[model samples]
Structure formats: structure tokens, C-alpha cells
Target: METTPAPSNVDPNRTLLLVDDDDILRERLARALAKRGYAVTTAPSVAAGITAARSNPPRYAVCDLRLADGNGLDVIAAIRDINPDARVVMLTGYGNIATAVAAVKAGAVDYMAKPADADDIDAALQASGDTKPEPPDRPMSADRVRWEHINRIYELCERNVSETARRLNMHRRTLQRILAKHSPR
Candidate 1:
């Protein structure tokens, strides 16, 4: 029987490590990436991710910026230590310029906000050196930006609702309501 070759864009070493605390997101992304031809391994925290990387380094990684146990930047550092050429992408619910810069400095090739679909991630993973990926067709709306900013401040305040509210100059009850709701698209 004759067989067709894999696409040139697909890496020969298709090993990928995905580290995210969100169980549903992790599984869904893993399945989608697998369909795209990656051999995926997943972890739920910084420690697990580091252990996995040390045991069997991956050629690509998608790590959450805020893990249950610790920051995902630590995982990126570990992966880079194991294989400097590894392509790591940072995913965060609280997306901001500072965190994105930090992710890049920590060895992540790209930074994506939460709710990133599998297709967008796949494209990012396939991006070659120095080549910028296409911008999102629908950027986050103003409401979404406000939501992200509020969430970022909340995190910075160590998740203290009152402190976040004070910093954002929003009423505590109002901030609480916002926090209770899902992020705006």
C-alpha cells in the first residue's frame, strides 16, 4: 500500500505538553491538538508540569499563566531548561501587556487570553520563528477589556474583593456582581 507524507508544516517531533488547571479546557484542547497530529501530555499544576517536562521533554507546550499551585511561567522555565528550543505558549484569563512581556521573557513564544479556541492555538503553535501570527478577527470588546482589567486587579489584590473594588474605583457590591458573572465576549 502507498502512503502520503505528512504536511511540511507539521513538525516531525509532534510532542506537546499542555498544562492548565481547568479540567474541561485542558481535555478539550488536548483532544483538538491530538486531532491536529500532536502527541499530547497534560498536567494540572506547575509541579506536575515541571515533572512531566523533566521526565519527557516536549517540543511544544501550552501553559496557563495562573495555575492552582503556582504560576505557569515556572513550567515554561522548566521546559526551556530541558529543551531550549521548545516552543511554549502562555494562556491566561487575566491578559495584560506586563504579563505578556513576562511570558515572552520566560520563554513563551506567544501569549493568549482565556477562551482561546483550539484553532487559534493550533495556528500559534505552527507559527515559525519571527513570523507574526494573524490578529484575531474579533478583538475583545470594551466590556470584555473592562472585565479583564477588573479581574487583573482582583488578582493583584490577592483576590480581595474590597481591595480590587477600591483600586478600580468601583463600589464593592458592584464589583462583587461583576466578579460573579462570566467574562464578556
Candidate 2:
């Protein structure tokens, strides 16, 4: 607990601390969570997250595994120190079962890929115990992994569908068609 105060609009009881390095994504996520009526305090680096969490503890946290300054696992560690009861969801752009397992072992209640939505994160935070989802322990084929990453990133970008489409260098329709094929029946 440091001296930094919670945002004026935040109710100390139900606030959520969000730690991510990606500025645009972090801000967008904060907005989305705020729309859901949860107070949000954002930190763009590990040190900042730790300081912010210690200063104004929140009921729950969503942290990116990688950050511009350092690893977000450090943020999780600090959160646990400040409030052991705090729920945490670990997020990463490079999704892997090992990282998920490690995050849980290191204090995260759950782990997920970066493109996760605010709702998914909210669900993780709401869990009362270990919330990690153990994806099958097997190496995915390169193509399969790429496809999964693409879809995840697309979902994360939300309105930036065109950016994702451009990155893939295919027309928006092509990307849309591919996503449609993969959608569950």
C-alpha cells in the first residue's frame, strides 16, 4: 500500500486493476470494463502495476504476461503480496499451456491469450478459486497455431478488423470468410 489514491470515480470496493503494456489495447480494455460498471485503474508496465496495486488495492486484476518494461508476472506477485485474496487473470499474446500453468503456480487465478474479451476476463476474476483452463497438453501444428493466433488477435481488435485483415494481407472478405468457417456450428 503506497500513497497513490484510487481514481475519483472508483469505488474502492469493486475496482479492478488492469496491467498491460500495449497502450492502445490497455486503454480500450479499460474502457470496455468501465462500461460494465467496474472501476478500472490501468498500469502500462510491471513496476507501475506493482506500485499502483500496492497503493490502491483492488478486488481483482487482469495482467498481461509480457510488458514493455518487464514481465507482468511481477505484477501478479505484487498483487498477491498486497492482497492475497485478490483474484488475478493472466493474459498473454503468446498462448501456451506451460505459461498458463506457470502463471497459476505463481499466483494467477487464471490464464488466457491476449485477444480475450472483457467478459472472459470478468468471468475469470469472478471465479472463487483456481480458474485456469488447461488447454490440452500437446504441441499444435504451426499452421494451426497461426490460425488460432489470427482469430484471437482479430477478436481482440474488435473494430480494427481492417487492421487485422491488412496484416494478413488478404481482403477483409477473405479474412471474414475464414473466420466464418471456423465459427462453431
Candidate 3:
């Protein structure tokens, strides 16, 4: 996606809250948003995100769906309490219909699966109420979904092959083979 230049007449007072447990992602996205002319405040957990919102609520926010401390939805709620007009987007590595619905119900303006770039995010944040942003038209194939699920579980298991294998009820060799292959499209 092409990067959007910040509006020529930028709003200096419009800050954006970015919350995510991944340090690299948070930092990188923060830089991108900053380049886009937003004052970005970042947090690593639900508590921190909420605290930041309470201290100085932002006009726009991007929250991870799953955080190390708690669900990102709570942060969204806090932002809404502080600034009901805040436009929020929920990001997730394990995106699904249920959670997408929950995010909208929790006052998120948009939801995006993992691997979303700065341009995609900027587009989501800038989109107007009359036009809702939509995800890719093609859904992940079953094999791709299974691959993603396994990878998520493996990561959660600290990349322990045996543990991931046991948790997934798959043989160790099979798990290894799956992990060795490139991710499906």
C-alpha cells in the first residue's frame, strides 16, 4: 500500500494512542504514524493503555486484540469513556468473525488482521463514517487457517516443539515439518 502523506493542514493537537505488546511493531508503527504527523503515545499492555487514555485521551487509537496483560477491548472501553468520539481500530494476529464483531460492539471503528502496514492503518483511521473499510475479499483457505492456528499456538508455547506438538495433539515430526515449511497464503 502507498503511504499517505499527512494532511497539509495538520492538526497539531490530535494525538493517537497505539497499544501493542510487540515492542518492535509498536515502535515501528509509532514512527510511521509520527511521520504521518500524529502525536503518538504507545503502551505495552491494557493497564498502560488505559492509563495513557485516562491521563490524556487521544483522538484516534490502534489497539492489539490480545495483549500480555488483558484483552484490548478493555482499552477501547476506557478510551470511549474518556473520549467517546475517539476512532479506534483493533488489530489481531488471530482474526475471526466473533472477535471482529466484539470489537465493533466495543466501539472500534475498524478491525484488521496481522501484517497490516502503516498505510493500511492510516487508511482505516482516516476513513469516514459513510465508507467503512473492508478486509480482503478472499478469506484464508482451510489449510492456511490451520497453518496460522498452529503457528499461533506454537508461539504461545514459547516455540517448544514438544509442547506445541502435545498441545496440538500432533506427532513431533509432523509439527516440525509444518513449522519448517513457509506459511501458506
Q: Which stretches of candidate 1 lie over 4 Å from their true place?
A: 1-12, 145-169, 172-185
The window of 10 residues in a row where model 2 has the poorest summed lDDT is 1-10
Off by over 4 Å in 2: 1-11, 130-185
User: Per-model C-alpha lDDT, please?
Assistant: 0.85, 0.77, 0.86
lDDT score for residue 143 of model 3: 82
Provide TM-scores for the models.
0.75, 0.67, 0.81
Expressed as tens digits, the lDDT of each residue in 8-47 for candidate 3 is 5557676899999988888888878888877788999999
Note the residue pairs that clash in candidate 3.
Answer: none
Order by TM-score, highest first:
3, 1, 2
Screening candidate 1 with a backbone cut-off below 3 angstroms (N, C-alpha, C), the clashing residue pairs are: none
Query: lDDT tens digits, residues 1-185, model 2?
Result: 11223345655577788888777888888888777667788888899898899788878888999787998888898898889988888999886888888898878888877567677777677765654443434434565656777786686677477888987787998777777675331
Q: Quick one: ranking by lDDT, best first?
A: 3, 1, 2
User: For candidate 3, what is the TM-score?
Assistant: 0.81
Q: Model 3, stretches more than 4 Å misplaced? A: 1-10, 134-149, 181-185
TM-score: model 1 vs. ground truth:
0.75
